[model samples]
Target: MKRPLLTRLLALAAGSLLLSACISQPGPAPRATGDLGLVIERASGSVQLIESTGQSSLARIEGLGDLSHASVVFSRDERYAYVFGRDGGLTKIDLLEQRIDKRVIQGGNSIGGAISQDGRLIAVGNYEPGGVKVFDAQSLELVADIPSTALPDGSRNSRVVGVIDAPGQRFLFALFDTAEIWIADFSQGDTPQITRFEQIGKQPYDDLLTPEGRYYIAGLFGEDGMALLDLWYPERGVQRILDGYGRGQQALPVYKMPHLEGWAIAGNKAFVPAIGQHRVLVMDTERWQQQHAIEVAGQPVFVMARPDARQIWVNFAYPDNHRVQVLDSETYEILADLEPGPGVLHMEFTPRGEQLWLSVRDANEIQVWDPYRLELIKRLPADSPSGIFFTSRAHKTGL
Candidate 1:
């Protein structure tokens, strides 16, 4: 074995080369990544597709008309996004291809819309024509047109708000000028069976369905409290909850309307923002009564609970709009007061409630935060952003 040192050295060199080649060998092809969510750029009339895992932007889709008050809902498969715009534009976009599949002008002015339980029908709430229109989700064809013409004065139109899809293929909406909530049953055909509940409340501004889509709650501007309709038991009609909640108290001048989208339910208590007041109403959901009120520095715009229902995050309208406050869900105590920059329009928690993404309009950026640690993690550049929606919304109801 010691006879030829050169032969031994040559063998060692060859072995080393073989080992290096093996170590550098390519493994299974790297799986493609970064298909995640959408960021609504209000001023630009476009949506920037972003990947949450990587925290990166993929593409900015343009030509979406009048995205000033745009909202989006995904297909059942999450392959397509239906964008409802303020200019009455309904666009079906192929998310995989990053292109618009179909577009239609459904009305002159639109606020928002909802998708059916089966994802087969899309209903839009219009302000200009004051009605809700149902369309075929797949082909974007008109199926039903239910106008809000049944007012006490026999008016032909009334501003529509809070259009939501309930269980059993029924679409429920509230008319602003008419003060009514109409339930449109589409189980039979295009001409839905309209059941109108009138005089529910005065000047219902906006409405939202509970996380489970069981209750439809509408906020009123002309009055103090809200109207609650139990979809599970429609025979009970509409019950006005928290009547004169602001009675006797001198409400501060509201710089902007308090959005009901911020209302959240944590541990059977629903936290709702008080219009023109710097506080949130704590409600016991089971009894449907006001439990307590949590005071804040400014009028709350969005009072959202963490996905895990541990903490409640509150943001303001203006003046104090630059600050965000976190409260302990159990103790109802202030946990942390954070300044996430100016113009905090909306906040969306990840599906698991680990992280929060907030849209800062004046700053033109989206800030990501760790709710548990109360620290800033990342910041994304956006143009007058409003809503931060994830593709995971497809799996859940009333997103």
Candidate 2:
């Protein structure tokens, strides 16, 4: 039928309005990921996506294999979290979408992982079958397989520990059974240039890199000292420091190994957990010499410093795990002794050290504290929480 021009224009306008109404509906709100983080639920093999700003859990992602001793590293954008599970499961999670983006079982048992400087590679350190596996950060495909040194008996590979990323696309780790430190340089390509430092110590339990990535220090379990490697001058090899700090005294029973990653450096002094002892070893960072051994509540498991380096927080092993002592960095005095709850497993500070997040496994809670005020601000419930990792670690070295 031939319609009038005014009638045809009105019909077309009505159709346009209908289409616009159907397609232009509002969607979900967009949010930034800078304040986002994850908390590891050790027993359930899951992680809770948490936002630091609101200090609440946004979502829970499950089906991660085993998380008994899980740890996480974030992509450069902080939008993805790479969780290394104790069952050797490497799961890449999409923080914004709140889902597992990819998963791979790369080893028999895994300890931890780290992301490359360019955020392209993800490396996992395996405890069983012993070695490290590097994967493509986006695809979760194997990129490189670095087998740890063979054992003294040539039976199996040595267990790898303390895998951390360095500047220049290099990854550093220690061989537990072989007492060695290795640097895998990948700046060139897929095949890494290996730099091995043998006999660094007896049983290099764990390692840590300086804030600027200048030095790599590995703590020894079979001895009283530690091994230090100056990354700036690799030709000089590893040097032994703090030799015989134990003074050949009968060592106390160690309930748990002290985590070297929790080492604290405040100004010129470095506070390290003295294994099997109830004292925190304060060392002069310049000479790497022991300055003081401040007595603490128990065998210090984690001696961590606040971001401002004003105070240090020390957590203990079992039996005394309920107590956490705060120490003044300058005065080296015990400022506060807090008994938050039983089974305090891990602690993490906010980006600027505004709030401290602690995982109380026995209480099944994540307690947020105002470090300066020394007060508990909030608590979020979880299922056997062990590690509280924040996105701020994405920008830091050796987190």
Candidate 3:
């Protein structure tokens, strides 16, 4: 009780200093991870997380179902990835934690999926069950199941392809057997506003929606033309473009089906691969008419344009699968020819189109290149990599 005044004054000053420190101190910042990229290992049923810049694998996630034709769509924040597997397994992967958060088997066979414009729903296209299923993006809960039952015979099953998100909480897809285009609007309620445009085309294989989300184009497998739907004016229904494009021409045996994802729009023109043919159908988007056809070495599998629209890159099917060619978008001249070796499954371009990444399955490697210079920069090892998807696609319309 007989403490000195100096001791009491020192204690009071220490208390004041501690209070000031607590008020001004800050917490640790959130973890700063690099731009993460995923490489789908087709045969091994695993995914390799790699840096988009460094080209190094950071982690590998396994136990994903049959990944033979797996594709991934990322969450709006890019923290999670919803992978659509061929064996009907939908896996929700946490990119930051490098593990599976939730998984479910929704069907017998699934092709691909798309995330909604609002980032609240995930819709998958099924081949076995022959319909599309919508799910809650966060919990992966089944929300609605719209079976493709538009066949003439009243069959409850019809394969759905090219399931893609559209504006106004809607989805656009094609029926493989019924040759119809169906639009499901979910903005109103769980019972979607369904709009069916029948007889759109013969055996519509795959479709692509324009960057502006205005046009939905589907390629016909039974015929040479493609069906175009003006989403802005749904009253016009579907119009056929480039009719009889393969007329009077002998077709080649396609070892691998051509993907409409290969189709690209550069400036005012769209470059489309001619099915069972060795040419690319160039169309003027404004008029939707065929402008010219450029001949290539083999049947084109993927025909994509550079971001700047200065050039187009074309990949071929078997017998010519090992070759890749670049073309001048304006003059249609062959700019470069590259043989990146066999089993080249897919390719992706940087946002600015400055660089390109290609997956070579048989070689078990991913190749990065400077397309303008036609030089290989990096070759990273992979396990039968089939698809190279970037997080940058999260904002795009028709990814």
Best candidate per lDDT, number?
2
Models 1 onward score TM values of 0.89, 0.95, 0.93
Q: For model 1, how does the per-residue alpha-carbon lDDT over 1-399 read when each residue is reduced to its tens digit?
A: 375988989999999999999999989763332246778899998988777776777788998889987888888887888889999999888777877899999999998888888899999999988899999999999999888865567655899987777788888888999898889988887789999898888999888788887988989999988999998898999998888889877878998787786688887899999999988889999878999889887999889999888899999988998999998878889999999899888888877877799899999998889889999999989999988877777766654
- What is the full ranking by TM-score, best candidate first? 2, 3, 1
lDDT of each: 0.86, 0.93, 0.88
Candidate 1 lDDT (Cα, whole model)?
Answer: 0.86
Q: For model 1, what is the error of residue 384's alpha carbon versus the real structure, in angstroms, after optimal superposition?
A: 1.2
Q: Could you tell me how far off, in angstroms, the CA of residue 196 lies in candidate 2 after the best superposition?
A: 0.5
- Per residue, candidate 3 scores C-alpha lDDT tens digits across 282-382 of 99999999999999989998898888889899988888888999999999999998999898888888777777989888899989889889899899999
Candidate 3 has its poorest 10 consecutive residues by lDDT at: 28-37
Error of 1 at 304 (Å): 0.6
**Predicted model with the maximum TM-score:** 2
lDDT of 3 at 194: 93
